[model samples]
Target: MSTVAIGLLWIFLYDPSNGPINQFTSALGLGQFNWLGDPNLAMVAILIVVIWQFSPFYMILFKAAMVGIPEELYESAKIDGANGWKQFLYITFPSLMPTIVTSSVLAIVGSLKAFDIFFIMTGGGPGNATEILGTYMYSQGFVNFNMGYASTIAAVMFLIAFVCVLIIQFIDYKRKKRGILS
Candidate 1:
């Protein structure tokens, strides 16, 4: 689904008065609370929305990585009496390290560029409570018509994300080198 659609759906669900969330709370005698309007809660609300939207994608990545691991490793571990947790720790985790690093990089970069949900949901409202770099750049470029500043913000975001990827690669390289040395 498009970000606009997801954002609208989340807005409807999180609406303070007649939203299903508030309604459910009221039904449970917890009373109504503004989810997106409150300054303190708006960021939390956005966090929840982002997590809900992306968790399944990450889960699929993890599942694929786990499935790619050869069955022989797990079979040997099981034969050695390694329980589920030990098997996971000794076999699954090491095998998934590359996937985990790749996923982390993707997630970090995607998050740095995230704008749609915040734009549609809050528009950086409630006094910029949930303003992120992407939304801030949009606001600066389009809303304020400060193209120069917006470009600078975009550059900075790119730099930050690039640095993160480079750092991950460096760490992975060092780990590989250490493994070879050992």
Candidate 2:
């Protein structure tokens, strides 16, 4: 689903009185909780939506990585009397490094650029509790009509995202080199 749709759905689901989330919580004796309306929970609410939206894609990526792991490695670990945890630590975990690195880079950058859902859901409201750089930039540019500040914000966002990706890649490269050298 589109970000807008996801945001809208969550907005409904987070409705203070009638939303299913509130209903579920009430059923569990937690009472109806205002999600987006509550400053404390607004960011958490957005995070929950983000995770709900992104989990399936990551799951598929990890599943493919898991499937690609060589069966011989597992057999070798078994012959060496490695238990399940050891096998995972030595064999499966290392094999999934590339996928994990890629996922980390994507997540770091994507999160920095996340705007639509935040805009749709809260517009950085409830006293800016859910405000991120993207939302702030948008507000400065479009809502407040501050072009220069908005442009600067955009540039900074780009640099931050670029640096984050580069850092993650560099770390992954160094780790890979160390593993290969060993």
Candidate 3:
């Protein structure tokens, strides 16, 4: 339900031909904006929208993880006279670390490859304010008819994503090896 609400909000904010960002900026008393104007505001707004659109899945995952935690941990903590914060810090956090890392990685990949929402929202316009690598690749390939460059961009994006995942996995592996992971 929450996810559906966020998705609807994102759709409402997304305007291919006309966005409300300019009106918002002017209304906020951000000074007379001419050259360095609405695009900046729109970019920020779009980012917020994107994060909001993506957040519900993370929220669900976190909620489930939290609920899945055995009550015994808290009970034991209570017996030990550990406060809620202390118990959370010493127990819940360590348990949730892996879930958080996994969810973050998924979010990063989703962001890097995101296009549909952005395309419908901004069309990578206002001087390319919302031009992500994914959209940029599409523009270069289809819009500009430069398949070679677009392919190169695709390769680079893939490399960057692969490297990030590799680094995260490596760190996780090391932590597990060192008996630091739960």
Instruction: Report the number of the highest-TM-score candidate.
Output: 2
After superposition on all C-alphas, the RMSD of every candidate to the true structure, in Å, is 1.8, 1.4, 4.3
Please give the lDDT score at residue 6 for candidate 1.
91
23-136: candidate 1 lDDT, tens digit per residue = 999999999989999999999998999999999999999999889999998999999999999988888888888888899899989989999999999998889999999999
Which structure is stronger by lDDT: 2 or 3? 2
Task: State candidate 2's TM-score.
Answer: 0.96
Q: Over the full model, what C-alpha lDDT does candidate 3 score relative to the true structure?
A: 0.75
lDDT of 1: 0.92
lDDT of every predicted structure (CA atoms): 0.92, 0.92, 0.75
Please give, for residues 1-182, the per-residue lDDT of candidate 3 as tens digits: 45345545654544333435435655788533332136866677667776766677799999899998899989999999999899989789888988988986897777778877666566787688878898899999999999999999989988888888888888888888887845
Give the TM-score comparing model 3 with the true structure, all chains together.
0.80
Q: Looking at model 3, report the run of 10 residues with the lowest lDDT sum.
A: 13-22
TM-scores, all candidates, are 0.95, 0.96, 0.80
User: Which residue pairs clash in candidate 1?
Assistant: none
What is the per-residue lDDT of model 2 for residues 45-149, given as tens digits with 9 covering 90 to 100? 999999999999999999999999899999999999999999988888888888998899889888999999999999998999999999999899998999999
By lDDT, is 1 or 2 better? 2
| Ranking of all candidate structures by their TM-score, best first | 2, 1, 3
